[model samples]
Target: MESLIAAVREQDEAARFLVWPGDFDLDRGDHVEEVHLASGATLEGFAGDGAGGTYFFCGEGGEERPILYADSEGGAAPVAIGLPELLRLLLVVPWWRDCQAFTAEESRELAAEYLEDMPDLPARRDRAAAALGIDLPAQADVLARLREVAVRMGEDFVLVLTPEGHPYEPLFTN
Candidate 1:
């Protein structure tokens, strides 16, 4: 956990976006006790929240840790495993969300434009890919793969949280 936190802190892009609760002195035992009391589950680690949801690590020690997503409404669901895998999933979420509203070509163009706007995107991409044990491809290839993952994971998997509501209700319910 310390290594993961250190890595996230070293990356400028990650440090700007990933909000680890411990970084804010909110990962104390009292906080975990409160969570356990409120919900029957224990909090292994507080990863971060974005797009109107919080990501957390939950599992007993000596077991495989699963990453869980808690929506703004207090609903929770498992999303991925470990911090590195969760970070990888997060990197492609925007691309997945954009694909829903745009055509393939438009999505690709938009992804490229978005990456172009982020000066440190390449480094971030490299970090995420290395963590996930996957290769980061060109913009077009990335868009294609994002679409493929969305299709494979289903519509509910690529939920987009809007200001008015949480789109992850269906995911949580199931």
Candidate 2:
């Protein structure tokens, strides 16, 4: 994880793409509000997005732990089983946040918008992936796995507010 982060930080274009399209900023690991897991597992905030959304590594361990994404609006979801999987999602389908329906057509439509804005998205993503030593999956496959992680495996890892003791709503739905 440290090496991958260093590689990303070393590259200007890869860092820019991750910050813009991927919505991932390693420097912003702190969460705005107090949060925890309903299961009482350790939730470590390791990254954040532009909209105050945090990516937490669930449970104790290393970067191999499951990752849960919690939005400022009190919504959360298990986005990936590990850091590598999460990076693949970000590098392959940076438009995952815009994919509400989680379908191929929706991905294509959203991908078009990104491609129009950055024609070298694929090439840039490839370079980023290569730097991280990760082989990304297809867009549809990544999205599908994302949904599966968020909706299925996500059931066991729920996010909750610490002070209010209120649980966050699920970000993904069947």
Candidate 3:
């Protein structure tokens, strides 16, 4: 299969949509700080958000490797096990950063705000998903999976500040 990064580069609308609501840019893969995984696994900066946040592929592998998100604020979490899952989260819930609670009610409120800003979020997301050949799951499912991945599956994938030898704080609390 062709790499999702390659696909994103080739698909204009997919890349555009990801840039807008997703706040994701393939060109901004550079993380601002020096960091490493506690397990000493290979951490590759693959993508980034508008802020100085980085999306890293943990361990040695292709896009199938676990993904860790580290924000400039020094918080980190394992958002997804793979690139596909991470993209699904971005596509379904662009306001994921605002969703500290990660509840259906909170998501609904954030969705409403986003809808007000970009009423065509669903259509745009659908086109992006189609372009990327990704089958997006329901918003609830995506959020639930995010919670599980960041909260449950994240303990083993701790991000450490290489400079100070201190572990980054967990982004997701519940």
Candidate 4:
């Protein structure tokens, strides 16, 4: 997780857009640690938060971590895998879901472009969807909605989480 964070920090685009929670001293039992304790899932790192909830990347380590979204309701759902995949989804899914910015064909093309070089992307996507207890079709629907929400809110917008799973809106410029 530390390595991933470092890599992200080095990238101007990712660092600029993917807000990190470590910036604020929120008394929320440590976001990654708490989630690890609660679910027995090892925290690889955190992605960001949204109106939907706080999102995290968890796994033992390596190139395939499952992205999870946890909310104030004490519920968590796996959304995607790997930092790259999650970022791609964040960029394209919402636009696809809204159906206002891109057509289905365009959405697929965009997703493909963003997901280029990802080996076995379909399988990874399926694993994430299954972890969330969603079927294939439903998974697609959720991604669309998730994408819509994330993009409309702003690429850099992230809500910091309290130890109790409550979210605090953090001010983000650009």
Candidate 5:
């Protein structure tokens, strides 16, 4: 298991210390719904007319998925409607690191850094091709395929593609 997963599984103290500020609406976008906790505690997050806040969830891989939502009358701690809905909620949010999940702001920052560090998407693609010792044309083709994969599976899961239109298998044998 990845170290992050291990840390969460062990229930590290840091896990509890992390907090995402948001109004957790348990209603699944409904007008009237009841929200409670495992311990049956009545939970209210952000309350009042025209209030705004955020709620946080732990992702399947132990990453924090923080989401911000607002309601005219405020919100409450999100109740798990079901397994699938809970899973969907997990995908819509970003992976948290340390005390906070990557907010929309953070994603922009990271994307900017990545673009600045590379400065050339096509060149980076070419270099990736060269690192795999593939020809330029084949590399371009594979990159196109990867781009498609990135579009389709983005956030739902992580994917890596090869020049042959196959998923890139990490080098784990060495």
Candidate 6:
């Protein structure tokens, strides 16, 4: 399964790709949406660049999840698609002006840290922005946008709780 995702990522020529398994089958939209809702997220499609060929849609549970068939070809393997990188690609790319440039781990750490400290979603987002060194007044919108991206990325954003009920880390691995 990892190999398959690796193959996709190894291509490295896709302009944009989504990692949602539910987005693949139009019929399963509701099911995926239900799962997303249960996880406190909503599923929606975001536009991607026309270049770089295809958009890879990796589904839940790593390579076991259905990979979306794209009109074009080329992209990182599903497994290789780092959560932070994926979030940056999906959420930040659209808001290029307010987004910060950071590696996947940095993004994940910042987002997690902000969420942990702030607890409140809005406040957490503000901290996220500050952590990223952004001063956009529209931080609320960015938070909402990031939430949508998190839901879309599913397992990647599933926070694991410690014995004391604190978010210890993301549940899934890339």
TM-scores of the models, in the given order? 0.48, 0.94, 0.98, 0.40, 0.17, 0.21
- Residue clash pairs of candidate 5: 22-53, 22-54, 22-55, 23-53, 23-54
Worst 10 residues of 3 by lDDT: 96-105
| Model 6 alpha-carbon drift over 4 Å, by segment | 1-4, 8-60, 64-147, 151-158, 168-174
Q: Which lDDT tens digits does candidate 2 get at residues 72-122?
A: 899999999988899889988888877888898999999899899999888
The best candidate in terms of TM-score:
3
lDDT per residue as tens, model 6, 1-174? 234333334432221122221012222222111112123332222222333222234434432232221122211112113333333333333322122332344445554654575355444333443443334433344444444443345444332222333332321222
Per-residue accuracy of model 3 over 62-112 as CA lDDT, tens digit each: 999999999999999999888899999999998888888888889999999
Name the top lDDT candidate. 3
Backbone clashes in model 1 = 0
Query: What lDDT tens digits, residue by residue, belong to model 1 across residues 112-135?
Result: 876677756656666644653444
- Evaluate all candidate structures by whole-model CA lDDT and list the values in order: 0.45, 0.88, 0.92, 0.43, 0.29, 0.31
Of candidates 6 and 1, the better by TM-score: 1
Ranking by TM-score: 3, 2, 1, 4, 6, 5
lDDT of 5 at 157: 28
lDDT of 1: 0.45
Ranking by lDDT: 3, 2, 1, 4, 6, 5
Model 4 C-alpha lDDT per residue in residues 73-152, reported as the tens digit of each score: 44444445555555555433533322333345656665575467554455554444343333444335545544444444
Model 5: per-residue lDDT, tens digit, 1-174? 243334322432222211111112232333232322233222333221113332323232223332222233322222222222322222222121110222356444644654565465345434433432334433223223333323332333211121333222211111
TM-score of 1: 0.48
